[model samples]
Target: MAESDDASDSILPEPIRSVTPLTGPHPDAEMDVIGWGIFLGLMLLLVPLLPFIIVVWLISKLVEALTPS
Candidate 1:
């Protein structure tokens, strides 16, 4: 029974382990450029939100005008 269990365990295969040694942070130029691109893309994504902001502001003004302090 013990032999069968051992054989099954071996047949299942162990999880792969990293062979490379752990090193400190590695900052490369290409990675830096990619990071900048992602940042720019995020900022550009805000362009579509402008109309929503204006609509909300206009609604608030309309509500204030109708409520009469």
Candidate 2:
């Protein structure tokens, strides 16, 4: 069992084995701000539109299913 575990660990990539948690400030604060701003803006704009999008998609799929191929 120990030999099998060692073999599995050896097969993993070096970066996967050496992973570490972030312990310092973000490398680029400006980029972080811009990224978060864009993410939030999209969420705000898309959440309300989601229901309509889903309704449209379902209607299209229903029409496709009902029509002869």
Candidate 3:
């Protein structure tokens, strides 16, 4: 038992363990404010534009109906 203990201690000079987890992208990653702004702005624009888009589509359909196939 003593010899086994000595062998194990000699085999590893220092304890090989990590106190903190390996640094990963999730921990180091940063948010992109410009990207967020662009996407948010586009979403805001889309909400207002959606009604106009539908109205234009309806008008186009009406025009199409007035014309021959």
* Top of the candidates by TM-score: 2
Model 1 agreement with the true structure over 1-69: per-residue lDDT tens digits: 999999988796678889998899886999899999999898799778879989999999999999967
Model 1 accuracy (lDDT, Cα) = 0.89
Clash list (residue pairs), candidate 3: none
Cα lDDT of model 3 by residue, 1-69, tens digit: 999999987785677898988975563224577678889999998999999999999999999999987
Worst 10 residues of 2 by lDDT: 12-21
Compute the lDDT of residue 51 as modeled in candidate 1.
93
> How big is the positional error of residue 44 in model 2, measured in Å on the Cα after superposition?
0.3
Off by over 4 Å in 2: 1-26
Worst 10 residues of 1 by lDDT: 8-17
Clashes per candidate (backbone, < 3 Å)? 0, 0, 0
Candidates sorted on TM-score, descending: 2, 3, 1
TM-score (all chains, Cα) for each model: 0.39, 0.62, 0.46
C-alpha local distance difference test of each model: 0.89, 0.92, 0.85
